[model samples]
Target: MNRFMQALGLSGNSGRGKAELGRMAGASLQETAALYPFALLAAVYVLGTSPLGLLLLAGGFHYAGTLAGDRQSRAGGSRLLLPALTAAAMAAGILAFGLRPAGAAGAAALLAAAVRGLITGRKRLWTGVQIPLPLWGIALSVILYVYIAGSNPPALTPHRTELYVLCMTNLFVLLLRWNTDQVRSASPSYEVDGQTASRIAAVNRRLTWLTLIPIVLIGAWQGFGPLLLRLARWLISLLQSSSIPAEPPKQEESLAAAELRHMAKEEIGGTPLWLTILGYTLLALLSAVIAAGVAVLLYKLLSKWLPERLRLWVRGLLQRFRRLRAIRRAPGEQAEYLDEVERIEGVPPKRWRRRRPDGKRQYAGDDPRQAYRQLIARAMKRGFVFRTSRTPSENGTELETGGRYTDYSPEEVRQLIARYNEDRYGRR
Candidate 1:
């Protein structure tokens, strides 16, 4: 045993040992890949541009989803085509949108990998339903951007920005369904039979509900959005200001060119460069604070509404107010009485009981001393003190035999014992 323990705790760094570790890690990666073919797409999305980035995010979610499904079914296959096609389409979109060639190709390769997984049936990805992590990242981005940028200027662009934000939001919902930890943890409360599928389904259902929550919250925030905008403008006015001075147009400029330069100079004078920088910086900071606050609030709200099993997990980490729901029984008189008797006797239920003729056993339903009283009464009637045997016997116990104990007991004691026995074990 000592040798086994030592072996279990041993560490090694030899070439052969390192090789084995590498092999193990490689095998694990391959297994993860076959299951979640689009897992690789996530990295690409973070590095890709606009549509390409968003597409990869979606692909990652779909891939994660396929993994969840495969895990649910316990079937193994490389279900990669959907994600790959989705990724490829996204790359094509990036190219169409005028992103550089290298970026587009990189995206295309990622999509191809997903496609390959789809075509192959050798590997499968599995995790219970989860919202993709990237989708959450995007939502965080949107919240931050809107809070900082508002409806115009450097942050909010043409209508495309809104469309992109909406797309990211949708992806967030899908990701939550496939990957959110809150949803996964909350599942056990609704799952009675302890089946994984039921837990997974319940988690998915919760994600569907939660996915819309952030959107709704942001929309509500927007109803009061103008107030925040005014506040931001006021703060911007306090920062340092800068302006570019105009130069004399000596000889070569045309009428139109000079007029344009004059307008440019006026615009530059109106908003200082330093002020602009400070404004953007302040906006970014405020946006960050707001996003963090919203995230915390959302987490708290969901944590409260979460099923008990999931709440336990959430509280285990947060150490927040934990609500433990116990089975609520009716006001039970019997339970109270039993508790009192046990407190007096210091004896447990298992220590007292005799098998009845009907194949049932009786113990202290309320009072523990009642058994002794009944035994004494039976002994008095039967003319002898019944032996208290450790083993079962056919005849009535010493208490049941009666007689001897009648003379032994004082009159007062006998009367009290008799009264108690009659009131208890008697017909009532």
Candidate 2:
């Protein structure tokens, strides 16, 4: 037990362990502080209202505002403000329109947040939003279904279908988010090579095509009219005729036995195939349309007013909250590579050429040759092999020819080689 406990500690020394523990505790506290508002809002939407719920709601809004303020500071953009306003608008929508409309508003707000995260390259923020958005969607669906079912018996079937649609839509949103992340991170820099660009473009096109399946399904449902009901009835009649015993269970049977038998026969035979297809296709199309619209709107907003306003507000907020100084620090991992690239670019071309002790010329000053070599090293780590005799450009050409570096292109390779060749041997 002592060994196990020691193993759990940071280096198993009380002083260092205590400091590490403190840091972990602080991080946990910060995370909880950030998340409590969303939790409270979720509770307000999911659980029945009470005085406590109202208090939580107020606290949640204030906390959300604080987070918005912090996010604005970090991204130099109005990262949080849009979502906060969106939430407020959604709440007002709930009051004015209805729960379903509010749910749509919530979805729009979530999509907007995701779009902002994607545009700003805030992977952590995007991922965090993705996790909760789906949960909230599912919870809202359940709550709405219950509310609708309780209010009117006849509405249950349609409401249930709507709930399924919502769930499917949520799933498609997740898929799109995943695909978008994949596309964005496909290359190391903003200027993706031709191959990487083509790959991303292809994936996006495939996603678009996949979207048509749902649209077609929805259209077919609209065109066909109640095919699911007809199919279900037909299946039920067939089952009743073939499987169910003509005679009722004997009186000697236990209540449990009779109930089980009845349930087995009565439970609507699994969802009709057509209904399943229709639900999925409609939901997918709905989700794709909403996500696409949100992405476009985000692009426009980022292109115009929001980013400047965010930077100003964040700068002011940072000045006021001196304690939140840590949030202002540059993200290390992301900046490190960018800094290296900038450093390489900052070097003068004349300084990049150096004569070796052996009288051979080489590219110096941490040039693109070094970056290309590093890329090769990384590829080796990922199980790619290159012959030592081959020059970096030759290897790059070989890789491109073999279709190995899907994330890079032959032109990019040639550019790197040209730079290297210029440094080694003066351009003719």
Candidate 3:
């Protein structure tokens, strides 16, 4: 009876554990899902109406979509592709619906949602479906103000509030998952295994290209966007002035003469905006270059004048830094072996053995092979035989060079043979 009761208890515990696991999985899916409606609204309100605002909204969605796609069970594509596709769909929907009559647009939106749902299925629909709601809310407010509430609403308007909300929602989602165990697990491995380290390095190099493109774009825009805009404005002004009829002075002979003078004046007075900006940019770049050159020169001078001890310290520090970088860059067991060698005490080749005066166990001689064996025995607390040689030539004489133990340099062998002969022949 006791055994049966114990088995029954164990079975109940196992069943409860499975039930709890199922509940947690369901909750996590729901949490991943809860933000779709708001995303849908944001999408509808922003695109086509506010160009920059639309871009910001798209960026936020792309970020959130990327995070979501990465977290999803089926990561079938690149982490960035899903988010990008979702943004594209949102943009398309806004352009399609926002430009149409309100009633017609509503039907179109419902149709689009249905079609999208069918094409991508319920999971992917929810994946991209939530972006239109906040967009709709902002669009509704704008459409109402433009058509009904105002006498003359501005043609250019942006749903700044909804854009802000969309950005915040995405930032929050990213932050929420930032602390997840999965993110920690996916981080580049520090103590990598197999080819994983090289793969990670390659991935990082590729991702660096992602950053480089944005940097180049920003650099060009900062250096040239304003210049181009100014040039366009100036060209428009020139055309406008050319189209205007100029009044002739009473003393002037002809209208053509007055027009030609006006043309010449305009030409003389008009500064090339591009050239002006280019000059300033060049000046700024030159100043930066000169400052950098001066700094480098000062550093060289200071290094030259520094105390010898200080220079040595700096050189040592630089070498240590280089060694550290090499260690960081090297692969495999070579690094570990170097680290072990650094940690252990030095045992020079020559002074490899020692013995106690009591001499319970003895060392034959200081030949490295014998010394190494002695050292090992001493380390392991084992006993070993000590052999002494005689035969003045074999032991310590100059002619002992051809002995079987003559692998050592002739001078070293001679020295060892001399010691052997001294000890053996002295007793003889």
Candidate 4:
């Protein structure tokens, strides 16, 4: 783990800034490592029924992705074809086993890797949209299980440790998803500083805790589940019983009312169900009241009795915490402050030469297509229109022959467009 973080430039207080080809490869590898579990879950739980080969293939796929990222980093171009091609091959292999769904998922993963930062309609050379592919895979896995099993698996009791594992796994995946997005979408020139990194860490912790909310809610439901079900049945029975025509009357009361009376007297662990329910409800209410009172008392006591120096120190800590919280909320201020601080501290901002844009959404330093994009932007800026419908070659010829559009040589314009076309479409 330590070695992995170091390799990715994601270790210690200041590792994850200023995107480089090497760092990009390392980050891509980490994302793949995170993805390996998806294959495992599928093998163990997703209807592959424990195919060990999938895991090995997944590892190979990630290794390939890492290599592709590293190559692109060193090569100075936009071709990240290797990772995508590797994924396609994996998909094909999975399909050959007749596991169509798993094969489909692998194909989806391929697209997520391969088409990044490529021309896509209105947005030329745009990064692929980020999606929680693992989450989708999990959902699909469960759906497949349900379809194949004839009936859904038995309702899980809270005692199953795997449920908690799955929930925590869910939290982990979400955090990785967030971090991957953060790393990929950042500008090439951007550097992640200590405070920004800290803020990201804080958000990761918050998200990890966020998953606990649902787990806690689910746990709480266990206590209420039976009662709720009984009440629902009672209500449904009452609604249905009201219209019963041929029912024998018991003491001039309807069947539902009789059922209610019977339920009231029903024994739950040697105590009447109604009495047990009342006792639990009263206990809960009493506990809530006492807890609230204690909280209020603590607040009042702390405000009144805390020493002046301690109070000030606490307030300072709180202010610092608030600043941390505001990092994402008020990023503009944070950005300015960070830059200003870096300048004051005499730390030259570190930068890395990008081989080319890969899965990292950042535009690479020597990216072949970047120059063409600049030309397009400049053409738009000069109050003259380039024909959007025409190919780059056609547009270049039109500009050169038309003779009214440029301060530079018409031949230069033609050559520029030809080069742009060659890089954008002709280059493999």
TM-score of each: 0.30, 0.27, 0.21, 0.31
Cα distance off (Å), candidate 2, residue 106: 13
Q: Which portions of model 2 miss their true places by more than 4 Å?
A: 1-71, 74-124, 127-136, 139-165, 185-191, 194-199, 208-212, 215-428
Candidate 2 per-residue lDDT, tens place, 291-340, comes to 88766644432433357877677657755565344345647544221111
Per-candidate clashes, comma-separated: 32, 1, 18, 2
Q: Which prediction has the highest lDDT against the true structure?
A: 2
Candidate 2's TM-score = 0.27
**Lowest-lDDT window of 10 residues in candidate 1?**
334-343
- TM-score for candidate 4, residues paired by index: 0.31
- Residues 320-367, candidate 4, lDDT per residue (tens digit)? 776677566765633423210011123234533433345222332454
Model 1, span 1-428: residue lDDT tens: 33432332212533333432332223223323232213223333333334335444444534443333333234443355365466555665465434766446545644554443342212332223222333454455555455435555442243333434444444443444334445446665533444564557566757666865665566545433564676567766654322334456668878989889889978875656667677777777887888887777566534545689977776665532211111133254432221111123355665544555553223334442564444444444656433322211212233234434433334334444454446554621
- lDDT string for model 3 (47-163, tens) is 223333333333333334433433343434444544455445556555544645542443333333333322332143322223233334434444443442234333322333333
Q: Count backbone overlaps in model 2.
A: 1
Query: What is the lDDT, from 0 to 100, of the residue 165 in candidate 4?
Result: 39
Ten contiguous residues with the weakest lDDT in model 4 = 338-347
Please list the residue runs of candidate 1 whose C-alpha ends up more than 4 Å from where it truly belongs after superposition. 1-127, 130-132, 143-156, 159-224, 227-428
Q: Model 4: number of clashes?
A: 2
